[model samples]
Target: MVYTMLDKATLLPDLLRRLDKLPQGHALDLRTYKRNRSVLIRRIGADAFDVTEDGFQKERFQVPFSGLKKLLKVLFKREFPRSTKIRLYALGAADGDDLPTGRKVI
Candidate 1:
């Protein structure tokens, strides 16, 4: 498969779409490089997410899927806002991934 890069402008929205399709209890972690601030979003219910934010302040709360967007804005825009553009550090489950294309495991 070809590699496609996503910018901040597109990353968040694409992430939301993937989150919407994720199975319950699965988590998607979003982190920034500056302060190592990251938000862990876990699908706890059909319409809710269990969120935890860290870096500037540590807090945890549950919100509807739509609320996840607002929460991200608050943290990334208000709390630890960055002045320059950079990549979104997502997909924690793939940390140090090694498998290449067309490889499947059962």
Candidate 2:
């Protein structure tokens, strides 16, 4: 699922909680900020890891709870939504006057 920056803020807690429940075998992929983020969990026996982006742009490591918390605190410095700009495009409108989008006001 693609998430806007705002969506990420709301969803992060839930994601973290879910990760807490997963054993050392299950895997998950998480994208945070506008920056590309992905992780793979390979059960090489019985251990967990924190994977990062390629190109040495980011670093991944094995993390305990404290390490995870610290990583989160440091990595979240960038404000994704604030930095990214989105242009909404509409294909057609009934009147053809303006592109229609967003929720209807009731």
Best by TM-score: 1
After the best TM-score superposition of candidate 2, give how far the Cα of residue 19 lies from its true spot, in angstroms: 1.0
lDDT per residue as tens, model 2, 4-91: 2334445446546655665554444443333333332222223344434322245555766445655554444432334233211112
Once superposed on the true structure, which residue ranges of model 2 sit more than 4 Å away at CA? 1-6, 32-36, 39-48, 54-56, 78-106
RMSD after Cα superposition, model 1: 8.0
For each candidate, the alpha-carbon lDDT, in order, equals: 0.60, 0.38
lDDT of 1 at 62: 89
Question: Against the hidden true structure, what lDDT does model 2 obtain?
Answer: 0.38
Error (Å) of candidate 2 at residue 92 is: 40
